[model samples]
Target chain A: MTTQPHEHIVKSYDEEQRRLVEEIVRMGQTAVAQLEAALDVVDRRDDSAARRIVANDDSIDAAERRISQDVMRLALRGPMARDLREILAGLRIPSDIERIGDYASNVAKRSIALNASPPMPHVAGLRALGLLAAGQVRQALRAYSEDDDELALRVRENDAQLDRQYTALFRELLTYMMEDPRSITPCTHLLFMAKNLERIGDHATNIAENVWFLLHGDRPLPPRDKRDDTSTAGPA
Target chain B: MTTQPHEHIVKSYDEEQRRLVEEIVRMGQTAVAQLEAALDVVDRRDDSAARRIVANDDSIDAAERRISQDVMRLALRGPMARDLREILAGLRIPSDIERIGDYASNVAKRSIALNASPPMPHVAGLRALGLLAAGQVRQALRAYSEDDDELALRVRENDAQLDRQYTALFRELLTYMMEDPRSITPCTHLLFMAKNLERIGDHATNIAENVWFLLHGDRPLPPRDKRDDTSTAGPA
Candidate 1:
């Protein structure tokens, strides 16, 4: 059977759309791996490995730029409303993933500074928080690729766990700093690292919301809990 | 002379583009004002005012959604490559501005926590950093509206100044915490606030780069220095 011109166009456009989504998912996986690698560096105090992860963030950034170019090219083809939403999601989800890469890089950078002092037990808490954040990002990416709004909502709901973990880490680090003046410098580094992990969770939530926007258009997302209360937190 | 239908369509498209730029500028101005107000509350130690600023962040978020909708509508109109670049900028610039608003709100939130302790001299340093960040955001927005690549580059260059200010503040707070353990809690809050302000500067830089991308599509930008060395920072 001979393929018609209109069929060819439709097939090519669908292929482009599939390619764009696949690229975004790959980029997101890179960011997740970067975060896990960073967490490992924190536990092992591997400054060189941390530096490598920091440099690797550029790949995710390059991915974002490429995805943007693809979206713009596809967009200029006069996409319909549904395709336009896909184009917008293509733009936004990568931006969020790029930021996740940055947060992961920041965590790795802080780990190098964290290595200056003796190891503290708080690194385990940070690891737990980082793992949770990575899971959120992974699930969000799955939701994006699968068009699973249910999974996106789950990712949003799960961010509260990451926030609570961060708050606990925040209070723990503060108490540790107060107990030993010498631990103040390293503990401060830990605090910023923890904040970065929490923000990674936020970025994951953003990606999930973008997935919802992709599927549901202008419908408002159900309000999720924001448990990151460290900004208002006081001494324990 | 009677205007043709095509000419009328061209004029309307031009108007839509102009309106998009103007809306983004206005939204950016709101974020800058929010940051300035957050800095004010930090200086005044006004928890109520801080809460107000936090609540006002919703306006910036709403503006972002509106701008995104406008961009999508324009993009689906089958714009040329140049106009498509503008549409992309419309998406990206507002996202950066929204993040700036979030950072500003975070500063305000932390100020409330900071109020639990005696006011320290570091608030002045924070205010200075915030003003610098706000100026960067304002300048980046102006660059976007005016199509001023030179001004965008200038804004990007000036972020180094913000970073140096942040690093100095980081050292000061760390030293203060090490000397007096009683100050650790408040100092930790100040450190995060400083980080938030520093991040606002980073977001401004992102906007500036987006302006550059809008003006010069696919052209590589010159490398700029990054002076935020706190990630590698140790005891001062």
Candidate 2:
């Protein structure tokens, strides 16, 4: 067999590395989709949607496995400095995405639990807060796939506001639980769902930070929001 | 210069690899210590321990930075097959440990919030659960440091038990919140603390799984437990 000059055979290393990045991007999209479905379940009490979200997590975990393999292969072949960080990015980004997927699944589980309870006050607030969280995840992934630090920084900045809103929502839910004990059960699931959303936002910020590190090398990241006393009511 | 028969006195890419592993092991110790301190804060409402845990997180971050650098340096220098996996382990394990540290800080923050509120019924349960979570982290790290698949498997298996205990604790807290609305506030804080502990357990399992992958090559990890329904009383 005569071997012709091959134009497509190149990029053995680059292709696998690219696949690792692409796989993570796909995983991020799936995670965002999962979050949307999970939030929808919360809003609609749709058991099927919850089931779908929980089932989708396996694919995200699978994507992480694929990325891990690609990273290992490329690492064994040895990478340049930049390639090394990219490989590290391959490792770091997926775990955050996977964890985000887990948070979405947790939200889905809460949704199933919420199915039995009648809707409580401030349930509407969750829908609004969820939009914010979902937006953060979307933007964070965009920054990751496109390597846009501006969008990543925006994601990081919005997380503080997200945390503040979460604190506000937690306070209001507590008030509802205090006012109507009947609200306690649904409200309890809602609070955990809200906390899960806030955590999803944190994971999004974490992805943003990873993107920053991937692009910027060893530069120090800005401090994430530390203000926890945002509730108007003093702790009692 | 006292030059011996050595070809060159330089990092043969192996020493740095070992240091990378060593650095992660040291970071693991610090993270477990932080968890211990954070749990102490929750148990005794020790303000100083809480502050110490919060402050200690920066060092863990620093530890992660060092590991990241080591990983990058080794990858750039190029590594053998085994060394490459070890380097990849350096990249993955530190992120999980760092997140555990962050969870510990969250527990510490909740501890401070609970400082003002009177102690609720399940506070002791948190201490017990914290021990379990802390022990898991320690054992997972031990598996990581020693490359012990059996111990890592044990860590993974025990996470289900941890989740079940968490479910039981959540039901009890919900009952307390329903019975006395005053327990609502402190119970709310306790619930978040408990959630943080559950998450820490999840991360420990993650580390154990990473250790498994690092030692045993690519393989399918079993499905983690998905049970969420454990509350005795139905919602609302």
Candidate 3:
């Protein structure tokens, strides 16, 4: 049977919808890169880089607003099954990206608060956590853009690993504070920075969940046990 | 002009839609109450009350889920103009409510973690902050339900007050930590609890913004500032 004109229009519409989803994923990846760069600023005490991260947040926020508008427009215009899920999922991705930008800006602010210096003894594990979290965020976005549920699941699983790293990092910092009471000032700020990275991991997990919801129409993972994950472990 | 039989059915459908919106507002109110109860638990270190708050979250969660389903069903069936906006707003409200619940749970968790004995210094200010935040949340929900822009704006203003309180509380806690290094453990948990209440205020502001959006179809408030309002006050 010959294709109907309206059907052809819908086919093009689907293409446009897919492109929008891809754009959101790209935006997420950009935000993740910004976060990683902010971590570098934290390590090097690069005030210029920190300021750049803070300023760049506006672009991320604008992207989020644009994506939200596009999603709402798409939903109002009406979408079919798969396209509907993709567009709805697209709405949440930008919020996650914006939050990642917030975390990056947090690290930047902390960097400014604590002037540039050599890596504090307890910061190595925190740095590792940041690198791992950034990687997971990027991977989650890639999995989403490519429609790879297996990759998304892998990204989700890495959240637990990130939590373990954070637990270890916190314990190390706690030990530092216990040994030298004066270390509390920088250590508290460092704790917040670590928390920002952990929250980025959480945003990645949220993205992974969105990917799963788009693919399967249900939450794919069990609710996490906060106690098991957030509790401090033995000295690192 | 004679009305069709289906017109009567549509009228009844509209009634159901209105009821659904009412239910959503109720869910929002319940969430605000949960936050208040959670604050009480934190202030009094009443673990039983905290446990009750935790248990109560499931009910709020279930209510939110039910309202979400209703919104989706109504949207699937078809909604026009005001009905469409109301349903969409109804959908957004629950997610906000669920986040409020999550914040309450965070407060409860911190309460459990701290387990600080009576004479909990630095707590009075935190409790005041929670009460202030809880009030904003309640007023915001009422404004949304009543379509009262004036009340919504009031809620927005209250957010700044909550921020000021959070700053004072943080400074007080910092002093406690500086005075007695051993107080750091409980103080740190108290800090997170206070932070959670402040965040709850932020989310309440978000709800008020959404309410304004629903009423005016435009964002009425300026975008949120990314700075740490808690840390910025000039050393208490």
Candidate 4:
């Protein structure tokens, strides 16, 4: 919650809003860790890491549920003006975090799917690219925790680079599939995981936009700016 | 707007909640149209239809903005009890609808990608599967507008069939690519479109769950039931 000087007028109100921020940060930190573990599963083919991400998802879901209940509870007290925006921002950010968790879980599932396949060269590249995307998620979480719009805007701008990374890796994956038909199965799984990471970056951007709104009330939603992931991605 | 017969405690409050429902119905109707246009693009390789969906997304975004604005305004009025859930549902449903539109647009974009590929035989199968998913979207929207929990629950149950349809298509598309490597690029686009439709169904379920809460008070978010799309999808 952005604190206006007048806001601490109600001490419990300030405390409740602080609780909301605390929940978002806790939820976000867990989600970011989940994304890293999910990628490490792909990079190392570590079944245990993948299972941990999959198992941990339920707790993330629970975290979002707690935040949602808290938001609705506080809204019962009738927050006005900026306080209302803070509650609405609460509604928006958790779903994005929950989805980021889902994407990470999906990646872990892909690890299970690819478990039988022989390792390929591009797994390292996918993780390299994935780390770039993960860093953005971390930054977005920071922006929210600190109410730092400049950091949020930087995350928003750098998202195009993530899209480009996905596009480039997509081409490499396709070439790998084409050159050796046997690579098709595991490669396709990798493709979906790569797309999932790119989307994770987009979800991070979604959170950054909310942070922007939390700081400044109503700005028409920023027109999406970026070469979407398909820019260098094949025919599509 | 689930009516408690004894309570029109504040007439303006009841009307405001009704207006909120009306806005969601309007948003749902436009989204349903966008889904149809998006599917038509896949069926006909219709560029103009795809363009129409891409262009009309602005209106859908506007619709969400209006609802969010209205919800914030009503929250300021201090809705509690049943009215609180209605406002929370308003927060929940529109974001899901906005995402459904984004997926529809992605499908439309995929239509353009496949327009040039020597038409694959599986295109029709994709369209058929897409319609099954679309019908659920329609049903979910109707459930919200009518406050029909049974219809919503039926939508929830039928989602399994959509997942099965997508998994089946994934296997088929993979087989097509393997049989003719030349088919890989186009088939991959179609694969993504199929996945998009599958995700659209997931979004519909997300909305259906919100409908469930709107009608009944607080319920633990249902653990996701049914076959996820990956149930039979091939190796990662």
Candidate 5:
């Protein structure tokens, strides 16, 4: 029952891969929590708390740096084709997560300025969008940890819904700005905040796509619908 | 004297690496060109040309995919520590370039909507910000191709100037919107376009940092200033 040296190497490599997945999952969760916390500060108009969330983004950035070092170390072990895919995903996914953290931090930062103005009803819409984006990110992280292509595909399919929500809110904000001249400054802040949430959804979708690549290699992903039409939107 | 087989493999590997750098440089140039074209359409208010620029973004995306495949292939060749850095840069720099293309497309898309409105003087300001961003991106690409860390640092340091320009334009747009409520819709579009240009500047800094990583391994980058203050800006 003695283990060969090759078997020992394989086991150690397996453990390293598992550690990489675990670290990414933790990093993803940190980003998700940051997003939720940012939404909370927006709801309560808690400027100090929002600033804290902005400061907290550095931890997610540090996590990315550490994971990158780990990926580089693992990559130098001369992995095979499949492990090479893992290495690529290892690099790609963390960068996406770091961006998610940034968007969340941006949301918090905007919430601080948003508090300076009188409260608007659009904050509720932004919170809902932020929650949907957080949920998608959570699902994508799970898919990556469990290696679930089905869940990854689900996350990818769900981005269009987020996009649609974003577009609806975008039109609503524009209408609001048009009606009330006094609301222009605050409404502009809400608009940027909502856009940040939409971008968070896009980043979640990016993580999901990386998960698919990790599982399926070079197989093409089916074309999915993109419903984020705000760029072409105008004042109606 | 006859060359050894080992030397032949080394020569071919060097050639492959050179090809990778060339492809990335070309891809980066495509993105820069897209940014400039998007600005042109903004200046001329040409909806058809803007749409064409939007369509051309697909090419930059395809370039990124091709570069990623090449990086994976190089990674599989079991490169040494230095080459591993190259492979990592090969993956990262193009993803940034691809995003630059996307932001350029967004600018073009927004320009279509903007064309429907009366032209304003702010397009000139956006053009200025975009050209600065494009210049930074061009320098970053050159730094990558030449492996010049000093030039990369210069690109990194120059982002604060871009940010200041963006914030100034942001405040100006906000002031314009407040003064003439009739201008809010078009001004809003300009705001987003300016934000896209600002994000382009940030991506250029990312590329410059990646170049630094490629050259210096794990050494920490010197802290740089960030001047994008629009998130906290208020209407004056």
Candidate 6:
């Protein structure tokens, strides 16, 4: 059977939609790379690299603004189910990306302050967490671009692992402080950095959750203790 | 000169607008009081009070939401310049109020974890920070209500004092860790709690900045340097 004119228009629209999704995935990857670079700067005390990351923040900010504007424009133009989901997902992805950049910049600023000092104890654990979180960010973006629901779910699973790592790191840092009080200064700052990474993981998982919602439209994940439904406590 | 009938309507609308602004000030005071209660729960290890504070979150949220909706409705109906600024200020105060609740809940969560343990070192400082921040929140709300730009400016100035207090508290905790490694556990948690209070102060300052913005419609405040900017290169 000959293809109808409406079919041709729909095919073109799908292609354009895919293109937009791809752009967002690329932006996510860029943000992940920025995180990695910032971590490297922190690990190595590379002021030059840290400065570069700081300068690059404006670019990430601009990218996020542009993506948000584009999403708003496309949404106003009317969208089909998949197209609508992609557009909404696009809007949220950039916010996560922007926050990731923010966390990276924080690490970079911390590095600048450390001024080439030796890495604190548990630095390796912090790096590992950073790498894992960066990887999750990239994988989540890929899953969204390909509409791979399973990969998105895996990204969500990884957040728990990151949290566990953070908890362990926190305890280890505490032990170090218990052994030697002098370590407290660097250790406390390190704790904040670790918390920041854990927060980034949380945000990545949030993005993954949004991806899941776009695909399945389920109720957003309930607070962890939904079964403790003593709502008589009311609305907290 | 003969009076226009429309002038009478306009005069009554102005009176109602002023009354709405006053209501927002009252609401803000209630929110600040709620935050103070939440802090007391933490300081006193009062679980029931903590639960009550958590329950009160919904009321704060609801009040803020209602005020926001009201502002939008009023703006849409064509508010004059002064009324418009007052309404916009009203809209912003709730966000600051909500954030205060968030900080209080954070303190409560930490209190729950402390589980009736004797107050940690610098617990007094944390309480001081909370009180100071709660005071600023109250002052900012009152400033918005009365359009007292000078009072708002004074509230903004207090953020620096909060920062100074936070810095001192952090150093004291470091000394504790140095004195005894076991102190690390409670001190680290307390550090996080202190940071949360400091952040609440920062948020209050942010609200004050917005108040300034509303009053003058000028460029926003200069970005404050991040507090975690201290270097590990230095000796504890």
Task: Residues A3-36, candidate 4: write the lDDT tens digits.
Answer: 6645554677778888888888889888888888
lDDT of 5 by residue, A32-122 (tens): 9999999999999999999899999999998987897778777777446667778888988999999999999999998888888888898
What lDDT tens digits, residue by residue, belong to model 4 across residues B135-216?
9889998999899998988888889889888888888888777777777788778878888889989888978988998888
Candidate 3: lDDT of A87? Answer: 55
In candidate 2 chain A, where is summed lDDT lowest over 10 consecutive residues?
Answer: A227-236
In the range B47-71, model 2's lDDT, one tens digit per residue, is: 7778778888989988887788777
The lDDT of model 4 is: 0.81
The stretch of ten residues in a row with the least summed lDDT in candidate 3 chain A is: A227-236
Ordered by TM-score, highest first, the candidates read 1, 5, 4, 2, 3, 6
Score each candidate by Cα lDDT: 0.90, 0.79, 0.74, 0.81, 0.90, 0.69
DockQ in order: 0.75, 0.42, 0.31, 0.43, 0.65, 0.19
- Each model's number of backbone clashes? 0, 0, 0, 0, 0, 2
Best by TM-score: 1
Off by over 4 Å in 4: A1-9, A220-224, A227-236, B1-9, B220-226, B229-236
Clashing pairs in 2: none
Off by over 4 Å in 3: A1-3, A79-84, A116-119, A219-236, B1-17, B59-66, B76-88, B116-119, B219-227, B231-236
lDDT of model 2 at position B229:
52
Q: Which is the better candidate, 4 or 5, if ranked by DockQ? A: 5
Most DockQ-accurate candidate = 1
Candidate 4, residue B104: CA error in Å? 0.4
DockQ (0 to 1) for model 4: 0.43
What are the per-residue Cα lDDT tens digits for candidate 2 across A2-70? 764353333567777677777788889889888887878888888887888888888888887777766
What are the per-residue Cα lDDT tens digits for candidate 6 across B1-236? 69876787677667766766776777667767876886787678787777777777678766765665554445434324445445445555665676677666666666665544456757788788788878878788777776777887887887888777777777787777777775666676677777778877776776787688778865555555544334333334
lDDT of 4 at A162: 88
List interface RMSDs for the candidates, in order: 1.6, 3.8, 3.6, 2.8, 1.8, 9.9
- The estimated TM-scores of all candidates read 0.97, 0.89, 0.89, 0.92, 0.96, 0.70
